[model samples]
Target: MARTRPTKRQLEGLLVTALYGATWWGILSSRTPFNWVLTVASGITAECVRHSSGRDRLDCLGDAFGAIGGISGDVETGIRPYTNGIAQTKTQIISHALKQLPMGESLQQRFLDRQGVNTDWFEGFEKRCAVLVGESKDGKTFLLKWRLQRFIEQHPDGHEYYIGDIDYGRCHEGDTPNTWFDSPVGQAVFTTADDIAAKVRAIAQDIRDGHDAAVPTLIILDELVDTMEDMDRDQFEQFMRDLKTIKNRGLKAGNITFVLGLHSTTVGETGIPQWLLRGVETIWLYRAGQERANFLHLNGKNIDECPKQLARLPRSFNGLRPCIVYSDKKLSVKAIPTLDFGNIEVKYSTVELSAIQQWEQDHWTPEKELTVLQKMREREASGKTPYSNRDIMPIIGIRQNQCVRSNEVYEHAKSLILALWESSKKSEG
Candidate 1:
């Protein structure tokens, strides 16, 4: 297409030069339809020539002369192909962006199936969320670690682990090999239930709204009872809502997978509802005992042999234990292996409650800041003070340069968040 149209003075000069001694009044004297058409066509041709480049401008001059003389056999070729090429290029870009985003069927699964990774361990789903439910000493942690190790090993493109509730006396706390700390992302060791919920909520939103490729992150949240122990009924409902949204929608992004561990599958015991559990694609039932019946019902199965197998399962602190695997309406008993983290030994430092870690800095937006401030406000209303500087920094997305001194974190954020809230309220009013 033409880069720039000519100015009024330039066009006037061009018309004068092209028409020789003929002026605007001279053309208007004809006052015929054919003359009016010629006038408009002549102006268009002149502008095209003025803005066009190289050989195209030279070819446009013949068309310009032809328009002035009212010739019938004039050819105007270059601009048509130029404009068409631009349109085609734009169409190609749009088509490429919409390739992964489908209108009818899901293209995410197709692309993942094309990747041809291992789903043998996953039961039914490809890389979606899974849950491990069993007694405390029933090797839930070890099996999850093994599955996660396999997930990381299978995806040669790399993966990360963000752990919540790394219990002090849990199986592999000191043994670093194949554990959550093996590839622990920056400050991702979540100590409190609140921090865990907040991070998961933020990540779910990112996966829902983002178009860029995310790193395949396996968020292993252990012991739901402990995680949601402090949340009241309303907060628990919101947390469940967030969890359900992510469980159903987060997996298709080809990243953002979860391996949540539950001590009991009963809704009353774990505070997790049947609706949420029914939606999970993969479930590992290890020594779940009475919870196995509820699990069986959720999967639309009533097999007698499943219970017999569950009853006969070994009950002791041993190696790998037999467990029931339910997925896609298929139920089978399989032995879950205990992961050996080898001779490598490392112990975690003392963990304090509500010690905030770094949230994703790049994805923090104005809307997210609003959410953070609201959370802070809730704590303030409850008479809960900010625990540490680390808590405020990650939640509010505060950079180091923003602070004048190290000692002003809690007080500064308290005053600032309240002020921002007031200002926002005024603006809305």
Candidate 2:
């Protein structure tokens, strides 16, 4: 087959002109200039039409002219807009990718008996909030705080936390209005029910809009008694109802949980309404010493055995013996052991505490104190003792004793030393 090529004159002339015009358009529009080889190679171009006042006809040679014109328009109108869109899209993709990544480590497997109970009790209950009411100093706050923390940690990508508390000492000085918007915990605020509905919506909107991360947020109403105490029964009922509304709305839209803590005198008083009780799923009762029975009653248990089972809990039970009751149609009781805060050398377990009580024939006596002191003096006399008074005090659980502050452990140790000295002197005589 025969083929024809453009003459060198035509190639060098029209193409050269087209290339120059295209290069001019590219340089004017670009942040970085066009390549030199492309400019030289594409120089030839068409000038097929004349601008005249007449009906236009398609030029037989308009393709080359149109191609040259298209290059200039694309440089001006298309490149920058397309590039910006791509950059924004990449940012969104990266953000979403980061969200899917898991936290560095999974939590250790510790059995939370009470949480398990609450899980079982609230199995079928929907549209509910738990009302924990009991004697002060019970582990209500401890358990509630722990569970809330665990829930948030588990659902890291659910919604951002929007915690609102009162303006107590905990709220910090210089905390201003809308200060929550600046909080890394995610737009938290300290406010009352007066404008809570609006503030909650605003915080929730920010989360939904993707401006904030969609992590499951906890709204803790600390000392709820302070706010709801003065309110009449109807008013209290209305407040509880409003919370239920927030719960339903917030949960459906994203992950939002509300936790409130109060004393029994407040939530159990005449100001509260009965209808509001239906909204709560789990009720935790915390009581210290002799109030365990009262706590049981609030959780829906009846006291059966009288004085025998009503014995006072040990003084060391301040942080011990975490028991739980589940709120189903009725409350079920479970007795769990206490946690021992001790060194490995003197680690006391619930079983060990009971054993020690049985061995002493009375529980946690100071009589063993005198005996232990005698042994320490013997060790010191023989120069076999390596540990000091500092080492000995904690072993007996008397170092940080709030009731008996040990400023001079040596004074206490001196008495034990004197007892041994007197006994040794008498034996020699």
Candidate 3:
């Protein structure tokens, strides 16, 4: 059919519609504004009804709307609410699209190791080093903070520390009030990669020299892969070198722990060296889609040894998020509980110096034993007695030095014992 030219009024209406469409699109999202264009055409149909309300008017609004859509404004496609009730029908279409996914997913639910869907799989990691893999805003930090909270509460004798490209120096207040992560270790602990590198080297060296970190301690590194990518050549080398030393010593020492967070598990993508991943036997998986293939390429083994659910984590706001926990070469699905910080920000983590000092004193070491006499003097003032050397020495499994010099020291000990015996006898008499 041949198309007729639009009248002056129709042309003006079309121009107005075009202008509104352009403005709506420019100010909003990337997708084209199709719904809004149809809405504008509906307004034009309303104008047609207004002008010809009583004379030669279309019988119904459905025909008018359809005519505005068609070339000659005459074709009617049924009900008054747009063509074939598309506006209402769209809702049903969307419901079908989203609803069927979860239903189908439930049917395909298979566990790699007797995995129950969305069940809480408490991860047990025997190794000291662990890797947490997740993308941005996947609650990686929130989960990390929760782990730290649990560690602090459970291990009163142990200490917790946080280091990262960003300072997560806030209490874990998003969920529980008075959470263990309430103490922020301060932003100074982790503000820059260079500073982090230096601090790591120093702490690791101190542990090796037996100067500090006598008790079990957890050291957390957040977004280290991102930091590595931003490093200079020399800086990266130094940082990795320091990290390697720290990882090896910390893992082997058994008293130290390492929790490293990265967006990717692969060296090519994450900028984490192969050696770093090599030392980590346990990898806590998050909602990363490229799970199986990347781990296979990185470690020559499957890190996604769990049920295939990570790729399609259920969209949620306040529910347990699915995570695949890989440990001891075993794969399993875990519904990791989420943490909420409640917008609390603490600047510095308070460390109880007295508690740490008390631990150091109670911690049995040969060097500490040499100061036993001084400590005994303090104890005696409070009507407290120190452990007898003889009893403690046996349990200590000391290999005695029986040289002449050593014998002289023992003779001096004997003289002191005899003197004490004489004093006791006098007092008894």
Best by TM-score: 1
lDDT agreement with native, every candidate: 0.50, 0.39, 0.48
Question: Over the stretch 74-120, how does candidate 1's per-residue lDDT look in tens digits?
Answer: 11133443343332232122123223232301332232233222225
Q: For candidate 3, lDDT tens digit of each residue in 6-120?
A: 4444444334333333344443443456755655565565455445543222122112222233322223223423453332232122123323443322222322122344544
lDDT accuracy of residue 97 in candidate 3:
30
Error of 2 at 26 (Å): 99
Per-residue CA lDDT of model 2 for 27-76, tens digit only, reads: 44445334654543343232322222121212211222223222332443
lDDT, residue 297, candidate 3: 38
Ranking, TM-score, top scorer first = 1, 3, 2
Error of 2 at 275 (Å): 3.4
Candidate 3: regions farther than 4 A off:
1-127, 157-160, 167-188, 251-254, 281-286, 291-293, 298-309, 312-319, 337-429
Give per-model TM-scores.
0.49, 0.36, 0.46
